[model samples]
Target: MARAAGLSRTTVSYVLNGDFRRIPEHTRQRVLAAADSLGYKPSAAARLLRGARSRLVLMVSPGLESARDTIGGDIVTRLGQLLAEADLHLVWQLGLPSVGRAATDLAPAVVLVAPTEEEAAFADLRRRFAVPVLPAFPGLGGFLAASARAQVDHLAGLGHQRLAFVRPAAPAFDLTAEFRQQAVERRASELGLPAPVILRVDDSRESAVAVLRSLRTRTDPVTSPVTAVCAYNDQVAFALLAAADDLGLAVPAEMSVIGVDGDPLGEWTTPTLTSVRSDTAAFVSDLTSQVVALARGETTTVEARLPEQARVVERSSTVGPAR
Candidate 1:
């Protein structure tokens, strides 16, 4: 096969084993075409018998089948690059049901990057394969709780006494968002800020607009307005900002908004979103290191603690509330 493709045996092996990140794109294509023409397939059992490490990592994306690339592309890309350095390969499995003990037949570790609700189905995968099942979100083992804490602290420090947390009604099992909301509530009480309101808005621009309308409008002077909002993610934050604009409200002046996930599109918004962003480099490194350790029957303190840092990225979307 190596001779047929005019490439070295190691190069062919890398391509066949899905560890071809270091291989040039054109060369990879040639190797792939050769293998396709020869009807060749790499057998996991054969590699294992040869004393080769499985080197495969399966990432399960539940309820994000259609938007995994859009939502998790950055994290996945960085994770692949980091793993490839150690000759490990990462592959994504869509839908929760597709993940089970059978998945460990292809990899030694599984990364679950979905909500907590989908976790139960994979409990058997952990018990059956003895493989580590890691969560990549902020809450539940990642940096989400910290991200929410940062968002709340930033807004409260700016003198926004009354705050709100906004999330979509769908993806009811999005424990990441749920954790962020809880963090905000806890932080508010700790800071002596007014109790924050939680709003489950429909996941649409129009729904957000309507929600903003009701919140920002109150004829009663005694009603303390919600001066700051922390959205579940950048998508919801963007909607709220747009809705605020439609109502002719002066952001940061009359109201402030912040969100999580640090989506690149947030920077392009009219007022540039202020967000609580994941420490991508640290996150990828920690997750990769922990999974690699788990694969080797080694344990790390990271398993019992959150491994990523969350910090606020200030932008035009926030300021001290009006007196």
Candidate 2:
């Protein structure tokens, strides 16, 4: 840039850094034009080392496998736009294994992590970077609990006294599964309903079929046969729907099903699925504000005021059980 602008390196540096009080206006314009022509962009690492704020925000998540089909992708897209408007770049680190390396390389102003991530990882990021490292949103546990309760409430409202909780068999989803299952159990107990029959299911349709059959045939004098299911996610619900179809069970009449995640695929199923959709706009907006504030070094410890409940998207899969 200095050579192209026909100026000293120091002169170019001052102009690029916006220290224009001493330098003439023409010199600053020349340097900027030269930089633009050369496509020269400032390095975030360089800015950070110089004790200046880097225009980088690092976002780390468990994985991107389901991002394209899930709300996770939408949240990331909106978050990037918001950050860009604030002159900050959102850099994603897909998995935890690479977070330390990515943060070191990017020199981000702040780090945001998925709520399901371990606390040790959060601490490591803060200790290594000396920057703010926080969950993408606060009250994640509360949100999960609320969503789970909403599922139970919807089924119970339809006179479903016997409910089953379908959890993912994958170990990767253990944290969220535990939270939602506990919430379902607690809500059922509070409503004077029988405890939810809990079961773990994989992605296989056969697994879902076997699980559903067991729920139907299991002899329990204390509680009635499972009439409704609260699945951990839409995928599980879809599996169960297929199982029900194979068994020739009339959905919402013989067995009602509700799921979390509000997956769009639900609409195309044999019976459209009822789901709890997490309204993430407010949470994303709040997160953007915190990222901007932290990047500007305004303050730390911004309280996350997330939504208390997730909205239920009612569909054909849930209804009053047959008399």
Candidate 3:
């Protein structure tokens, strides 16, 4: 580069490092142009050798297929853009055990865990890599809980006093489903309503039909028949919708339903689903800012600063209880 630009090695180095304030503008431009023509790029390994942090950010998550289907791609794109603006690179790795090798190999400036994973699970990674390991977004549990509360609030506002909580029977969703169900139960109690009946159903229409039939024919005095339902997610809600159609139950009349995760498919469903939408853009922006700050060695509180409530997208699937 120095030979091509007709400059000394020290002068070329100064220009590349942006320390050319004292050098002539023409000389700096010459070095930059030469480097550009040569297709030169800084080496992360070289930077580390020079006592500078590598410009790589490692993101780790479980190997869940649903991760990409639910806001994962959006997060990667938006967060990668933000990191690029700051001259950092983002590498997303699926699986927890693999992150140990990634941390050693990549030597990322910071490590980010998927929100679905517990931060405590990665505590050893932080100590081993001596890098910041944090949740990609803070307060994800709280955000989910708030979403569940929003469903209850929406149904309660529509005069659906008795409600049911429909959770997916999948073991993968057990932890998250528990969190959402607890929120629904708490919110209902707060609104002076009876606790929602909890029903676990699989993706199969048969599972949903059996649960619905049981709810409709309940003679137990402890809990009245529920007129509305708060589904774990759009998929669960779809199962219920299909079951309702199969049983000839009129939606939003015989039974109302609300869901979380505001999936786009909700729009195409019969009697389009009402759902609580997570602000993915805001979440990605906030998470990017946090990662950048941490990479810069800035101290940030662990507490989440995001909005406590999620927005409800109203659709045709919900309404007041029938008289």
Candidate 4:
């Protein structure tokens, strides 16, 4: 019915929200008249009693997620801070398509905190339901590319040429892998260095430890062995550190390691971790601003591609070239 009126989804949202401040008087009257004809009534009594902003944001994530990982915890904590500051309420939910979770229960909006979408049909979830469906990181591919470039660039600056990356079990929605690999290759080529190799392991401490443990027994220990690592996450970096200790391999001394996600666990490692950190605060600020702007029926032309705030905190993890 709103579509038939030749109004935008946002215009409809404004009418529903009852804040027709900017809506032209005639159009407001038409919207009201249409509502009257259609028996569209908003119960002020119910609204006053409910005391809830019909604004509910549903955060959809991958996996059953019976538990939250370390990065997940940090992101949630940061999101809560932003949501509170923005005077918004949030509800987190798993993005498992099999769960049959109903978006209908959410009052106004649904946000999927995913890198990418597998269910293409859900692209119109907003159009059909008068809600907003936002992909968290629109510049996700380039972000990953920059992240990979950060480490390689760091190693290149330090005169280390050969690097190997240890990755997590490739999540179905991994948008970063290819761009990151390409960026690594491109950087290596421009620097006249060999391309770094990627090694994938499950997103677990044990898997990370085992992969690094195996690398220590390299057959070509004399020459052309990987001297540096770009781990997928901070946890993987922790495992690599632990394995290096167990295998008696020197960090940065024998092998340098850099991790992504800027998880706090990276700090606790013995040698500390040289990591590529995300501009998470900026991301949350931009995301909340956009989502709220989108909610309030205001026009926005902002495209946020927050850059990688890559900081190479050298404690003992990374060092000068292998001499």
Candidate 5:
């Protein structure tokens, strides 16, 4: 194989074993093609026996149970798929102290998907374990900071003077929700729009409907009825839409609703949901690439930042307020 690729045995071994940080891309491709032609498959067990680090990628998160179908879930699911292609395995764990100890035992390259505030605790994990501790979502603080700014800008651009920032009572995810609320308020003020009304509703159809009903048919402050709402994510937005249906409120015509997480189900809603589409595919690609590189002991640079701009997919749910 080395002679076929016109490379030394060590170079071929490095390429086949995924240790190509210093190898030129062209040379790596030549070695990979040679291996493919020779039908070569590296032995993972052999590497383990030789005391090489385990090909395990541990995904740690706090709300993985309830976060299914959200952006965070998409990241974990997609990352697993990406890592598998690199001959790596993913083991998900809840961000608990016991799991932390288990992680040390496993000695896997770690991807922390926990809350932003908890990041301080993991500061020394990389040094302690001598394994990479890459971030999957760059923490909720970064995501919400970008997502919330996009939401407020989009609504204000659509001439929504009075807006409401709707959040769910998700205790595990409250830190993110609070930061998102702050982002909305800050952006709204910067755009010269009125301060947004912050509303926390239970994650239920009834609670959402009650809030939508009050916003739809209230009279004490007739001058400023909330014409638009920015939900924390698509699931919360779906609840608001269901509530609108129950109250017979005309979506977008009477109230405009926008959400984050470009969930496909958003399109099936009565008035297709307008939403901030997080670049999950791009995010997962960046994250898994870094984890795989780290696991292979390759020094490579990968950005943990979200996309420079948040893309809001316009659908029927968001439009100019009715005159």
Candidate 6:
């Protein structure tokens, strides 16, 4: 094990003893692997006989039971993998009732999820947890603006001038949506657009389609009805496509559309969607790194960063302006 890790026996022994001082992430990974291979387990038998459990890190959230987003699931999967790879066990627990402290006693290091924007989850996690906190999202404007800019640039290059965006009314004032709107507007103006259009809809796809239908029927004062549109996600983007069809409009010929999220459904749609592809690999990788770091009894600070940028994925849903 020591030979594989390129570490002296003493060094490997130190890591096996849970003394992680002065070790880089790679080195730590190597030593952990080495110890596992050599079966140098942390003896609970010894610790129990000694009257103490080996302290470990834990992931503290408002309520693991209430986090129902697929995105969140993906994050947890990656995090679990990273922790396992590091010979660390991840424990997820909820702390409610108290807004600033966990209900249960925990290990010294904790990973509290503080999303970038103000969220009920963030409030519960940050103020309630007794350990280090890691932010899930980026610091508002910059990330959102960048996401919008990248999308807008791609659509414009595809001959989209009269473009639109579809979003739902956010009760919490979504920083992501706000950022995109601002960036879309600013960039459109600099590019000589009269005004960038945004359509608000209820959360449902049906409502979003109805809004798109209303938008399609309007007289576009910009010399052209919007020929291209952005949907909040691939589902809505596909709904917009259906909305155009219901309105007797031909896609790309009469209108074109794009969406965010490279959801698997996007590819199966009649016309595959052009979307902002999420680098799920990178997302998972970073999520794993962060969570495992926390699970290993290491401190996760506010600045523990991960990539959140969305990339464009081109497909048949978009086409050049009518020939």
> Largest lDDT belongs to which candidate?
2
**Which 10-residue window in model 5 sums to the lowest lDDT?**
109-118
Clash-forming residue pairs, model 2: none
lDDT of 3 at 30: 89
User: How close to the true structure is residue 156 of candidate 6, measured as C-alpha lDDT?
Assistant: 82
What is the C-alpha lDDT profile of model 5 across 1-323, one tens digit per residue? 99999999989877666565667888988988888899988776676566655777876665555653477666678778888987678988875556658655666755554544356645644444556666556745766778889988888888889899998886865767888899999998899887887887887788998899777775645457799999988888999999999988989899999999889999899899999976757777887777877787776688655564678999999999888
For model 3, residues 50-146, the per-residue Cα lDDT tens digits are: 6665678998766343432354466678889988876578988877766667867898888877543454555655565778777665666787798
- Assess the local accuracy of residue 82 in candidate 2 as a C-alpha lDDT between 0 and 100: 96
Higher-ranked by lDDT: 3 or 4:
3
How far is 313's C-alpha from truth in model 4 (Å)?
2.7
Best by TM-score: 2
Candidate 4's residue-wise lDDT over 1-323, tens digit each? 48656677767656655554567767766666677777877754454345424555666665425432453466566766676654355777665563244455455444645534444534644343546677655566666777777778888788787778776565642435556667777877788877676777775666766777766655554457678887766666777888788777888788888877676766688888888766556776677777766655566776555455455555568876667
Candidate 2 local lDDT, 185-229, one digit each (tens):
999999999888999998788899988888878899877888999
Taking the candidates one at a time, how many backbone clashes does each contain? Answer: 2, 0, 0, 1, 0, 4
Please report the TM-score between candidate 1 and the true structure: 0.74
lDDT digits (tens) for residues 1-323 of candidate 1 = 99889999999887666553467878888998899889987787887776545767777766766441223678778878887775567887767675665464575544545544246744544454445676654344346677888898899888788888998777743555677788888989999877787887775778988878777873446547898888888878888998889888778788899987778887899799998776566666777878776654565776423435678889999999888
Query: Any runs in candidate 3 off by more than 4 Å, and if so which?
Result: 1-38, 41-52, 63-73, 115-119, 296-304
Report lDDT (CA) for all predictions.
0.73, 0.81, 0.80, 0.65, 0.78, 0.63
- Residues 1-323, candidate 6: write the lDDT tens digits: 78978898877655665556556667777887776787766774454345333344455544343322334456566666766665555566544454334324443344545355366666556655555566554343554565567667787888777778776565333445666777878877777665767888655657766786776777955466677777666656777777666667777676777876567777888677787754456655665666555544565552434444767888887887775
After superposing candidate 6 on the true structure, give the runs of residues whose Cα lies further than 4 Å from its correct spot: 1-73, 91-108, 117-125, 139-141, 170-173, 280-304, 308-310
Cα deviation of 181 in candidate 5 (Å)?
0.9
Error of 2 at 217 (Å): 1.7
Candidate 6 is scored at a TM of: 0.70
Q: lDDT of model 4 at residue 295?
A: 57
- Could you tell which candidate, 3 or 5, scores higher by TM-score? 3
- The superposed Cα distance between candidate 6 and the true structure at residue 2, in angstroms, equals 18
